[model samples]
Target: MNETPQKSQELKKVAECLYRNGNKVYFALVKVRGKQIKRSLKTDDMAIAKRRLAELREKAERLHGKENKNIRFEELAENWMESIKASLKPKSHDRRRVAIVGLTPFFKGMPVKAVGFAEIDEWRRKRGASISARSHNIELETLKNLLRYACDRGILMDNRAEDFKRRKQPKAVVDVLTRPQFQVLVKALYASPIAVASGAAAMVEFLAYSGMRVGEAREVRFCDVNFETNTILITSGESGTKNHEERTIPLFPNLRNLIQRIKAARPTADANDRIFQIDSPRGALPAACKRAGLPHFSVHSLRHFFASNAIENDVNFKVVAGWLGHSDGGMLVAKTYGHLRQEFSATMAQKMTFEGLSDTPPTFAVVRDAAA
Candidate 1:
């Protein structure tokens, strides 16, 4: 009889701890040290509410007799951004700052610890609907990093955002210009009436011949190029290369001649002066492409053209990767230009013959008849 009564009292207290609000959402209300605490479990299901109630109760008991500093998500985000500011480049930092701005509105007043799968999923469904998968994934990555930061500092026991997977992105295609097409485009640029067409033409040739990024190309000074060693030293100003390290690339014949010609034109130019006068050929490049009846190509397309041309010409991927400032030892180059290699191999395969076989290769009709 006494056992039944004690169980009844316990069940009643448990029932009182959890209740449904006007919106049919379950909320956990409990008393800690004579002060009442209430939190929305953010669910309508009774089973989930009960489980969350137990977690809330345990957390409340642990935090008892201590100052409850419920830090807002925005506050923690700011701290995390500040902590990483010194380690990232300005553009990188700005991108993360933009991600934070997108995240803050959804989680403004929510406590860092209170954010869980439900809140995260809700935010994802709402946010992912409006943005591209790549953009959404960036924001999601930033959110996960912030939660992990909070966990490291003991603000939360776990990073609930850790298990959330990112959306799949589509495969990207690399477009490049053929040698003849590039020559025509350059000629068109030179023939254009634009005041900057001459400088833009030179810049276009420099990018395609040297395989340097626009940013890195803009920072190349005359002193950085060594005609004696037949090499060009790539050291983008204060920030360095994309990998933050300087590298040396062989000055190929075309690149060497282009630099020499430019130098000859500016006979009194100082070694400290930049190699290219213009930063980019954005305007001239597109107009030239249109005038030539060719596809519009950006500065990056020229870099691709360099890599494609090199691979097709039998320049090894590792060497090309070094010239392009990729830290990965030829992996990216091989992946991007593998198709070209295949085509090259197929062309070379046609010339091969067995010692006992006829030197003449089988024609398509002969192969078709044999197959039949």
Candidate 2:
């Protein structure tokens, strides 16, 4: 028979004693907000049951900050994700999905507040030995973000990822081309007989010259080109937008002249047509490398090459960072390109004429005795 829960009726504790397992299980039938609630205390002793009773009393006392009864972390995660997904971009939404991919299994059915350092450490342990530090570090950052989301929505009391003790990995350094190398690459780009049509030559040259991203170059339109002001308008779209922030970059006279030459050849490109359609900006350089017989170059490396050249030539780091569309102030410039300055300084040290240093003739001019 079903019985209604009441605060006045006085709840009863039921104990089930098992002889085979030598375990004693205990539960209480009580009323909370006029509904009957049965909570089981899984233990094998009276002392444990008594301790659990004290814990239940303490939990009941702290109603404001405790995790909700029977609510799972996965359920909370689902609710939290729905609120943020509507505000993020498709790419950003996809990235968030990636952050949570390898994390779902461990914390799925657990309570929102149950995730702690120990549980996280166990999840990481299951990943086994082959995991790289870089990827694991990214996972840690992602886990922190999820906990931060939980705390923001009153699902968790605190962000515990801050307390985690993991070793920080040094960032990977990307190589940039020196001035002679960049010049060689540019010359190699324009070497082909049909280079004008390939436009790979023009595209890479513009990237090297202007420091524009490859996608930005591809999505650039005719109307965005301001010959009078010598500027290129980087409009926002799915094809090429830097985190959806639109900004204009000024063009140099040399770049403008190259644009005119390209325009003279094409002559019929509409104001909004795609600029580089012959090949992907990424693939162009590899093909160019095969032809030029030079070391392979990545599209991103061209931008790095430009930035390093600017810094080596005594251009301000802030100016270089802005020209490269880096949003993280000039930290990228400071961290990566600072090493190139040493090589540049070394070049300066070796720049002297032989006019005054050695007017004396070589000792070979004075024939020595063969017996000596």
Best by lDDT: 1
> Model 1 — which ten-residue stretch has the worst lDDT?
5-14
lDDT of 2 by residue, 205-261 (tens): 777777777767777777888888888888544644665677777786666877887
Cα lDDT tens digits, model 1, 68-175, are: 248889989989999999888888889999999988888999988799889999999999999899889999999999988877675765578887999998857887
Residue range with the least summed lDDT across 10 consecutive positions in model 2: 15-24
The TM-scores of all predictions, comma-separated, are 0.75, 0.68
Instruction: Give one clash count per candidate, in the order shown.
Output: 0, 0
- For each candidate in turn, give its C-alpha RMSD to the true structure in angstroms: 9.1, 13.3
TM-score of 1: 0.75
